[model samples]
Target: MIKSKWTSEQLAWKIRRHGVEMTHLSGGSHLGAILSVADIIATLYTNVLNYDVKNPKWEGRDRFILSKGHAGASIYAALAECGFFDVEELKTHYQNGSRLSGHVSHHLPGVDFSTGSLGHGLSVAVGFAYALKKDGRKERSFVVLGDGECDEGSVWEAALFANHFRLNNLCAIVDHNHMQSLDFNENTLEIENFGEKWKTFGWNVIEIDGNNHQELKVAFKRVEEYTKDENHKPTIIIANTIKGFGIPFMENDILWHYRFPHDGWEYDCAVTALHQIKPEGVEDRYTPNSIENPVLPTEKDDINNDHTFSHTWNTTYPEQMRRVDAKSGTNEKVHNV
Candidate 1:
């Protein structure tokens, strides 16, 4: 067994806290995305995945791909907490010239693939699993995807390929937070009967409350056993997670899909909220919406409201372009989403 330095819960808390700090510092979006998938990443790093920190490229290590690469902060935090690199180096995340891009990057030590465009990561993971199975290696390839990313036809195509090859060594977990970039998933593209779609593709489907640590651990264990069977099929876990899981005000709100904690009130409040989750008794320590702050997009307005749209565009579009200083050989960051 690969014993972790910190328990899954502890790692999850750190990932959440680090996510808040990283997003605040970098003015990066996707903190909500990060929180939704934190526990899944934490559980894998803590108990499920087999890896060597000293030798990240060890051939026997299991491969992990974050298909919803926008949520890269959580995985980066996990890798740092696991000693893949100095945790302090995380401050450079999304900064110009930093290896930590806004999306997951292979330039980092532990990441096997870079994925930001979405939906293509599973294809790469399927290839990895197929190669491992053909070589008769015990190694596995795991992928974490966003529920919104499922709208991509490429994801289903990869699913078909995995089933045809019967790549039992492959496991995929979807962060089914029910929200996309601009609004709730149903309001955008309804992926109803999500698990059934995977089952139709000939995959073993396991649906669970994604934010629950114990359930995540159990789901991973089941997938592990499924991989050992001679006639095993690829498994896809439909992890029904809240869009903004940890912080109370942010939970289930589509506004956070691209909102970062700015330097003042938002940053202070987010840090305070994450700090409330104690190492000993997280449930007792934390209170939902305990801090009295302005509720954005107000109760009267759904995410489609003009205020929400304007806020998103105002916060997201300004950061899209990057400029380089030709003589200084230094890059300047205008904005990052």
Candidate 2:
């Protein structure tokens, strides 16, 4: 793996910032899901996983899967920062002909699995772990799942499989934000004794504040040491996080799950919330489209993909917020903007 200059905290902020920009520009939703897992993704990509940005398909690399694909923007952001792709390409997210889709897509260079459907990622991770073990490979297989996705019976089935085979090289990270879709998980379908349930399934489990980078590093170290010692039990880290994290107005609010960052006040505020550190000289990079940008043709097929913008946006961009270089097409980095 290439050396990472940025620490986990820096990576988390970058992921959150990129997520807000991606959803706002593309008129997409799921910002709450993405923000909730930024630190988890940051920790994994920077501290845990063994990966190379240039050699993404390296056979010896650890396999990382995003089971909760709805929060895919975090993956894209992390990968981009890791040099898997150009950061400027992020603007085309969810746009017509853009490679970055709302859900995780394997078509991207760094992604290992394409999953929008819940309950499948853990199962696939199990299969990968089993295969790696059979081949006598020490490479680990990791999967990130959601607390809400625990409702799928298949998740339990995979849990049993992971324990049954004693896949020590497998690690599952659960983003337990508690809120899912229209309401909280308790109100929707309660999975009481969430941690105990995993323990009962015969897998080693670690529970920690998902947003705390330091705690996350320690948890990953424990799991890594256990697996490296040839301990033949899969491990799962249940990371507790707040939905719409880093954003004051959107935090713990179910409305942000499906809400779009409208062009004017809404978009600006959303970006502000995602950006906790707006250092000097880092002007806003996103230009609110004064005219309605056409949505991708495939959007019509999915009702949740629908987007509508009011004419609340202004045509003129403040000089301070401008990012596009008139002479050169390349965008300027406004302090990692």
Candidate 3:
């Protein structure tokens, strides 16, 4: 166990709970993807990254990019818990006119890059790492990519570039959650010999159970160990993870990739599954609007409500693209309903 004021379990639990709440409240997709990497995110925020949330951009801080940006809520929860923004501001996720778009955005402070298009983030991360190296900065850059994204040629191009340039400051993590959007990765595209693929590209590869906190903590340390050596190269950690990890019902279920749980039975079950033993004195944040007296969101309401949400910069994915969730049914079939 890496030394920290808070245990990795505590951070993981907080991230899992908060992630579910954000996605549930906002009716966002990729909740499974969020859960899958809870432990990894917690480990990084708690153990690896040298960051001060209060100073969103410290000159010497380590930079992390969520290449699988559909899981933006997971990073949002982590940032909030780490004090990047008020925890309450997360409720505005995916809401119209809110700064928190469905996809990851740099508009929010503490976020180094905005990414949603698959196979793009690793390239951006490489650029950041190269710049830091050129400036003779030891501060590292880390990028987390989804397994499904490996199919993109652009991803390979970035990989080759990082290896060619000897970007020892770069560390790439793959969330190898077997299932993709509609089916397993094998159905979409198979990445045979994952570790070999990275080694062949001249990266130092270490495969670990992505959901295991201890493994994640150690894997990052290994990267540091490699960078100090005479023959250093860019490193990649292939993390074997489970989609929809925390909730028993959603585990390994690909449907949750793009489908939001319904407001009725599915929502209740998901929330219940997320908190098997409810935390003491904490109000349930995923409570859906009552059917009888539905409380609809109004644009005029809370326009001035500020909870440390940043408005200093703009991201490529405009706020206009955020999908407004309707208060109704779902085409997604709720299991055991």
The numbered model that scores best in lDDT is 1
TM-scores of all candidate predictions against the true structure: 0.84, 0.82, 0.80
* Per-residue lDDT over 1-337 for candidate 3, one digit per residue giving the tens place of the 0 to 100 score: 1233455667677777777667777788888898898888888888888787667788878889999999998888888777788878988989999888998989998899999999999999999989988898888899999998898999999999999989998999999998777677776678878899999999999999998878888999999887665347899999999988877767876667776766655566666665664434444444422133434335653222321213222344544454445665433332231
User: Residue 310, candidate 1: how far off, in angstroms?
Assistant: 13
Task: Give the lDDT of residue 285 in candidate 1.
Answer: 22
lDDT of 3: 0.79
**What is residue 261's positional error in candidate 3, in angstroms?**
2.4
lDDT values for all models: 0.85, 0.83, 0.79
Q: Can you give the lDDT of residue 213 in candidate 3? A: 78
In the range 1-337, model 2's lDDT, one tens digit per residue, is 7456567887887788788888988889899899899999999988888888888999989999999998889999888888889989888888888889989989999899999999999999999999999899989999999999999999999999889988999999999998887777887788878999999999898999998988999999999887875656899999999988887767787777887666555666656544445433333445322224322224333223212122222455556665877899877645323
Report the error of model 1 at residue 210, Å. Answer: 0.4
lDDT of 1 at 80: 87
Error of 3 at 263 (Å): 2.6
Worst 10 residues of 3 by lDDT: 303-312
Candidate 1 lDDT over 111-148, as tens digits, reads 99999998899999999999999999999999999988
